[model samples]
Every structure is written in C-alpha cells, then in structure tokens.
Target: MSTPNDNPVPTVRVLPETLHRAAAEVFGGAYLIGPVTDQMWERSLPMYRASLVQGIVEDDGVVGGVARSWEVELDVPGGRVPAAAVSSVGVRADRRRRGYLRALMQAQLQTTRDNGALVAVLRATEASIYSRFGYGVASTYATLKVTRRRAVLRPGAAAERRLKMITPEAAVRELPAVYERIRTARPGTVSRPSWWWAGMVDRHLHKDRPVWVLCTVDDDDQVDGFLLYTVNNRDGWDDPQQAVVEVLDLRAVDERVELALWQAAFGIDLSEHLLAHGRPLDPVLDLALVDPRAAVTTDVEDETWLRLLDVPAALSARSYGAGEPVVIGVDDQLMPDNSGRYRVSTDGVQRTDAEAELHCEVGELAAVYLGGTSFTQLAAAGRVRGSSEVLARADALFGTPRLPWSGTYY
Candidate 1:
C-alpha cells in the first residue's frame, strides 16, 4: 500500500508562462494534444480569470500532469444554470499509471470544495476513471440519427406557434428566458448562474465563428424559444446538396414554442437532416423532420461523474422515488468517517446506524448516488448483494424514473 506522501512529492504551481509551455508539451507534444489557440484563451478569459490551473512537475522541472476548469452551463430543475466546468485534465504519456493524476484531482477538488462550488462536471474520455475521485455521471446527451421519414410531432394542447428568424445579437437577451422555461419543464436540470447570461457567451461564441441563432416568438411577441446552430457542408460531402442542421441548443417556453422551433430548424435551406447534441429523452423533434427516424438516433453520455464527499449530505439532497426503508453499508477509503451503515428512509431522510441490512464499498454506493447508476445493476454485476426482493426494492428506490442526466460539463 502506498500513501499520498510515499512517492516523491510533485510540486504544484499556478499558470506561469513556463508552465504554459510545459502544458503544451504534456498535452500536445507527447499527448498529440490539440493546441489551444490564442483566440480560445482570449474567449475563455472569464472562466480562466476565475479558474486556477494546477500542475505537478518532476524534480527535473518536467511537467507530469495538469488540470483546469472550463465555464459550463448548468441545467437546474427549471432553468439553464452556469457552473465552473472541469476540463483539460491530462498527464504526460511517460507518466502513465503514476499518481500524478490523483494528486492533481485531490488538489483541484479541494479547491472546488473551498470555493463552495455547487457541483463540478466533466465529459470523461475514459469512463473507468474519475469514480475513485467522487465524480458521478449526472447526465447523458446523445446525437440521434433519425430517419426523417419516421419523425412525428402531433401538436399537444399547446397551440401551433409562429416562427421568427432572429440573429445571435437578439439571442443574448431572448434565449435566456427560453432556456429558463425549457429547463423548468425538464428534470435533472441545473439553473444557470447569473454570470452566464450577463457574460460567458462570448467565450463559447465569438464574432468570427459562423455560429447562428434562431429565435421563436409567441402570439404576444415575447421570445418563447430559440436555437443556436450551424451547418456542416464540409462533412456533407455525400449530400452537399442536402440540408443538414446541427443544433447547439434549442429551448422553448411552451410546447408551441418548441414545435415552432422545430419548424424553424426545418426551414433551413438545403437542410435534409437535423443533428442535435442535447435533445432530451422525449423531444418533439419528430414533428418537423422529413423522416422522424432521422431525428432520434444516437444516445450520448454527458455530465460529470459524482462521488459522495459527505455521504449524509449527498444522500439527503435528492428525493428517493420509492417510499421504502433501506439500509446501506458504505466503505470509504479517503474519508473513513463516511464508512458505516446508514438508514435511508422513504420521504428522503437518512441516519447512520450501528447495524445495516446490506453492505458494500463506498465506490459502489457512490455509483448509484444522483441516480447515475443503479444498485440492482451493481448487484447483477456482483458488486452488491441482498435477496432478489431487496435488490428490486433498492433498484426501485434509487433509480431515477427517466435516466439521470446533467448537461453541463465542468
């Protein structure tokens, strides 16, 4: 067994010019890293200013690893929220299997905790990692490949809305309200922080990018929905003449607005297909595409992995679907205080007890927190055990009705 201090203590430092050079070498040089252009840095200045890039250098002054955060949008229960997204996490190839990554994660998570960040999120390149560090998958997004011939949207009670074409300039003001409405209707969404609307768009979309926005207005002339998207002519070589609309984000206040936005997307000239990155599980996209099948295709996994820093606080935050009593045994390596048997009751109450009904390691417990994974699945995989009845009960209680998803990447 090794300890945090057993290995040579790597020096952690802030971003200095020399460190940037090291970062390039660690990520791009050896890692075949995609270079971060100056423009990209200029755009990320908002998050960068608020963020701290930490690194560990070997005694010889070679950078072994680096970690940093990117500005992210939160999908609160009712609105689009903002969060400090974690990204650019990597270690030098030569340093594979070393503890550098772990050290960087600990230091970074400590910083996040100190900042009182609501949550830290990311899109994992390797799914196997991060769980050990307490991050859980909060949401999953997908790029659906639909056959336009099969799409369907029978307008719900919400009246058909009139569509309007608005530029990104107008979007800055109108899209926020639409996002607010859309997020409110969806579950597992986080609210965007104040700074996001006031600032941050400049970081994702600048004056040079060809990104465009279309707003959907209602009968009252109020902006009810909007879509930020671009075209893929280069990738459409086979269908150069066909219309392909790639959606960045589409949000509406009401079903009508949502339907209208769909219509608006289909209105794009030469667009035969629609490609969206964050379409919720049951979206109204089918209503407009020529082939509804062309609309719903790919299922994507997003959101950062979650770990229970404080089990009680984490467990009690969300409501359990099943109104049953459950005994959970948890084993924690990082914080032994979190290791124990906990009584989680219906109606979202929990307490630690001397004895528990079922026991498992902390990592397995963490997997099911936030409804990212399921206990039944864990048991099926031989990770946790109980009678079949108990397994089903735990699954019902811990499982999210719809899949649990967090859209923002930290």
Candidate 2:
C-alpha cells in the first residue's frame, strides 16, 4: 500500500447544502471580496443559494476551493442556449499549488455539462487564469467618459417632457419588467434571474451609497427606457462642477429611447463630466454627441469569457448567415467529447467525415463563436489555421448585423 506522501491526490465533489457556507467562505476569501462572516452570508443568503456549488473539501472539513454556477440562458446569434453562469470560483489562500482549483473547475465543467447547459460564461477577476481551462474572451466593453459641458443633444434626440425621476424603491419594483421587455437578446447577453435583480440592483441601492434612477415614459404610460446612476461628489461641497456622474445600468427599447435617456442625463447640474462603465464596444453616445469627440472611450476590456460545454448543441443553437458550408475542426482538451469536425451551414451544424478546412482550439473557437471577432482576425494572429477562401466563408457565415454585447454584469 502507498503512503500519504507518495503522491497526494485532490478530489472535488458536489457539496451538499450544509457545506455551501464553507465553500462560499473559501470563494469569498480567495477574491478578498468578503469578510463572509455568519451575518454577511445570511444577509446575502438568497443570492448565495442561487448557485449550485462544487468544492474541494479538505480532511479537516474546511472547504479549500469551489466552483459555483447559476442556471442562465446566453443569447447567441439569432438564438439563445442554456448556459451555466459560472461565478464565485476560488481556492483558499493556504491551498495554493495544491491542484484544488483545477479539480474544482474540472468537476464543475462536467457537472454543468451533465445538467444540460450548452455553454458557460464568466467575468474573470484575473484576466489570465481561465484561458487554460478553454475559456476565451468572447465579448468586450469600453468605459465612456462624456464631457457634460460639451455635450449637446441634437433635435429629436429626446421626446419633450418624457423623462421622469423615480425613487429607488420604485426602481426595484418596476425596472425588471422593463428590462425583460426591452432587452433584445443580443449575442453574449444572459437572462437576468430574480435573484439577479434582488442582489445586484436592489441590495446595492438599498444598502449602499445613494443611487438615482430616471425613466422615460411613452404615450401609453409605459416605461420605455431607464437610467441608473450614482453621483461622486467632488472634493468639496462648494466644488460641484468637478463632480462625476457614473451610469451604473441603462437600457432602452430602441435607439430613440436610448438617446432620450442620455439627453436627460446631460441635464444634471452637479457634474461637469459623466462616466459610463461597461458600455458596448459601439456606444450610441459616440454618435449622439453634437461634438462626437466630447464622448471618449477611456478603456476597453473583456466583458464575458465563454466556454463551450456542448459544442454541437451550442453550434446548432445559433443561426448562421448565408455562406457556403465549411467543415471546422475544434479541439477541446478539457471536454474531449467536443473535439470533432463540424459541418457548419445555414441549415445547421453536424459532425462530419469531411476533412476540416479550418482548424482551431476550443479557446479560439469560443472567441469567434459569438460573432464579435472575425475568423480572419484570429487567422492573422495564428490562432486559427485556414486558407483565405475558407476564412472568408467562415467570416461571412458568422457575421452579425449588430456586434455581440452583454449589458449586464454578474
């Protein structure tokens, strides 16, 4: 028989409900996002309980690492598929280099796959860690800073007398219905569960700093668009001009409604500048400004990192553009069942005997899967191998009318 020191083994298991708190402590401690004490966890209990967790339990019964996921649906090009919203993943501080994280991730992937999720999506705390697990930077967003003094709305930008201010409590009650109706299900977007509204929005507005909400009403008295923002007062109360208005969440049913909401924001008196985080790569603010240069993009970063759990199901779920069919070979090391050449056509995707014209690893495939990046770009970067003709065909097949964007944050 081998001794304990011969070669240690790490194992991950589907933790029962009682260990949820233990797993959450490990996750929160790893990210330094929580003191995760008994009281704090109880206050945020509903949201914590929303996810199914897999953990590495140590011999002493302290959870060492965890991978937690929520059941969500991620929109693809022209369709949506069941998705695992992977979040709160972490390894204990003392558990470094013990292979606990790897085991937890592998177990989470398999468990999520077996549970019928076709894809997994996450917002990475560290940019470099998840790629090795076949997660790719699938969608990106930019932080936009608009100079309020220089910003002017053109004629017809807003419906006169349509903007209305509402209390935070009202926002919690009403905005979820508005969001469900207005959200167009763009590729990379995920459905917001009830817990999302409660935790991400309601709890913050009620428990944290003062937040403001504005709504635009239509002739039918329906809320067509809304903006959620917070004000950062300048150094001194006398220096209101230097204050900054930060847009937290804004959604509109259409372009006109969007511009109307921004127009109202320009009317705020305390701030000379406004910053909107997680704005799409192409924001209407750039064009909505009278002087387009007044709205500047400060930085662009990855918004969603995606992993294909069931490649065939994911490939078939999204609608494709008109292009000649191409056999693309995808190699997934973590989920070997996803490795195969798939014939992609407007009709659908299917495993095929035909030799692949384009070849890429699962990470590269995930990058182009959502139609945000073109095959040609990845080919030029050497992540994709294909002839010019095949690349062009793949690009056309995956092209979307609007770029993929996920407006919500976990």
Candidate 3:
C-alpha cells in the first residue's frame, strides 16, 4: 500500500491486464461487493477499453484508484451538445484522503475539456463529495409506489394503443429508435451508446433473475414506447399471493403512449404494489390515475450532477428565455479561465468586462443551467449573492417550459 508520504501522481494509460484486475478488486472492495471474477472482467473489458480510464499507481506498482469517462450528446435547451459522462469512480480504502481524489478529478476535467466536451455529468455516489469540484445537482428523480387497489386508470385514458409483451432480444433490436425520438425532445437526456445498451441488457438477463419487456405500438404498426420490468415474489411459502412489480426502465414518445404503458404496469396480475425508482418528477401516471394520490412520490432526489468544464461553451450552447441580458459574474476556482463576466440573453452569450449584477460560484450556476431550480431559491439559501431585481431577472432568463429530467443513468 502507498503511504501518505509516497504521494504518487495519477496517470491515464492503457491499463495492463494485472492493473485492470487490481482496479476491479479495489472497486469491489470499496463498494463491499464480492470479488470480481475473470469472466466478469472479460465481458466488461470492451466497454472500458472504449472509455477514458485513469488510475493512480503506487510505488509498489499496484493500482489504488480508478475513474472513467465516456462521450455522450446531452440535450440542452435549443439543441444537443457534446458531454462527458463520468462513472466508475473509486479509491482504495487504504489510500483515502491523501489528495488522490482531487488529483483524479482535476485530471478528469482537463481530459474532458481536451476532448471538446462542453459539460461533464455523473450520478454521484455521495452528494457532498462533488460540489467542491464545481459540480451541482442539475436534475431530479422521484421514487413512486402505488397500491394495486388504487391503480385504476382515469376515464378517457388511451385505450386504442396496442400493447404486446416482447422478448428481451426483440426489445434490444427495436427500442433504440423509439427512445431516441423521446430523448431528443427532452432536456437533460443523453445519448446511450451501444456499450451502454449492452450493459443494460446484460444486467436484466442475469442467469438467476430475468426481466420482461413490453412495447406499445401505434395503429401504423410502429412501436412508440417500451417498459422493462421484473416481478418479485415477496411471500415465499406462507402467502404466495403477495408480489411486487418493479419497473426498471420506461420511455414513451408521448403522454398517451406513456399512459398505456403505466396502465399495463399497474395491471400486472397478482402484484400487490407497483414500485419504480428514478422516474421523472412530473410523471403522467399521477394525472392518468383516477385517484391522483395512488401513485405516491415516496422520495425525490437529485439525479444528474453537472459540471461546466468550459463555462462559455456550455452557456452559449443553450438558448435562454425571452428576457433582457443579465451580466453575471461566475467564480470558477477549478477552472480559472471561466472566471469572468458573461452577458446572457435570449439572443446569445458573450464575455464582457462590465459590472456584474449577480455573482455566484460555477457550481451554483450549473444547478440552474438546466432550469430545474431557480436563482431566487438559491439566493434565499445564500448560494447566490444579488438583489431581488437581479435574482428575478436571472430566474426569468433561465426558466424552462418543462421540468428538466434525465431519465437515463450512467
């Protein structure tokens, strides 16, 4: 193990087979999972080989830390822009708090910038760790639980759409196009590369447990939505009647199609309750149900954490609301190049030397970049320093028509 005095610098390189195994071991140890097998490593190696993997090596030539990033196109206000999706971040237990995390993050940001990605996004394992690195909560998700007794669909719900249960193989072949249609129109959604699809398929097709996929088709014989879910037999031998239906993934082209899918999910026979995690905050099921309270939101939490690597590039890529230009000062300690005054309006954005009406850290700005939160709320929390007039102007400039949500997890 490397001591605090050893302080080794992290490097990005083609990991050798031994180091790859060591990295996997460290990751499993950190997460308290079983030992990673050779079979598992070989199966996932192709995906990792395609990503940007970095690690900190000790003087004894053992891997103590690892992080990875993949390229993705994130949907912004006006259009989609290139983004870096970060994942698999971990450090060996023995090597914690020796500045390794800080170094790894700095290197990751610089590498992401070099790849010309405007922003960096991740599903943080801990909410408190990434803010110091200039990342902020950009989107939120809700956990839903609804009793089967109260799952009746409201009158006039879409009944014309045809629903069919399909094999997972069929779903893998047909669902991407349908998902793309919905993802393009939604803010905060990101492109799921082929490797991501493979991983999802592998996860659901585990030998011990299997998942089912259902599709909804329009009259024209085209699929408009898909839902992947699994059923759990809660009561073993005593009461076999109790079961739960858990939704793993769901996507639809429109509300009508979404309602059809939810109707099917709630209609699963013998299931006492329907549970879904990481669903959109504003779900259509809430309005589609006869009793709106049936689909209760048990928890709401941050989904996507965003970091603006290139502030100018990120700010200018998205279109603003119709409002007067606001001169805001952004304090980016990690990236000094981003520390400046920016004039943002519905027209465009430009760096200026003019006095700033509002001042905030880069992370605070990222929190509102997707329009999921408002500047007024941040000001009330002392996150943004400005007057009421400027706060309202900032809020108006960043407001979005729909609540921002990222349904995909990396």
lDDT of 2 by residue, 1-410 (tens): 22244435577888888888887788778988776777667756776677888888878888888888989988899888999998888888987776676777888889999999998999998898998999988899989898888988777765554778898777877888888888876898888877677666655655555688999888888898999988776453467666888898888888778888888888878788889999899887677677998888978999999999999999999999998999999999999999999999999999999999999999888998899899999999989999999999999998887778898898
Q: Which stretches of candidate 2 lie over 4 Å from their true place?
A: 1-7, 159-161, 202-208, 234-237
Tell me how far candidate 3 lies from the true structure as C-alpha RMSD in angstroms.
2.5
Off by over 4 Å in 3: 1-18, 234-241
- Native-to-model Cα distance after best TM-score fit, residue 223 in candidate 2, in Å: 1.3
lDDT of 2 at 288: 66
Instruction: Sort all candidates by TM-score, best to worst.
Output: 2, 3, 1
lDDT of 1: 0.62
Error of 1 at 304 (Å): 3.7
Would you give me the overall lDDT of model 2?
A: 0.85
Task: Give lDDT tens digits, candidate 3, residues 135-185.
Answer: 999999999998877888878885567888888777776677667766546
Clashes of each: 54, 0, 0
Give all candidate RMSDs, comma-separated.
Answer: 4.4, 2.3, 2.5
For all candidates in order, the CA lDDT equals 0.62, 0.85, 0.84
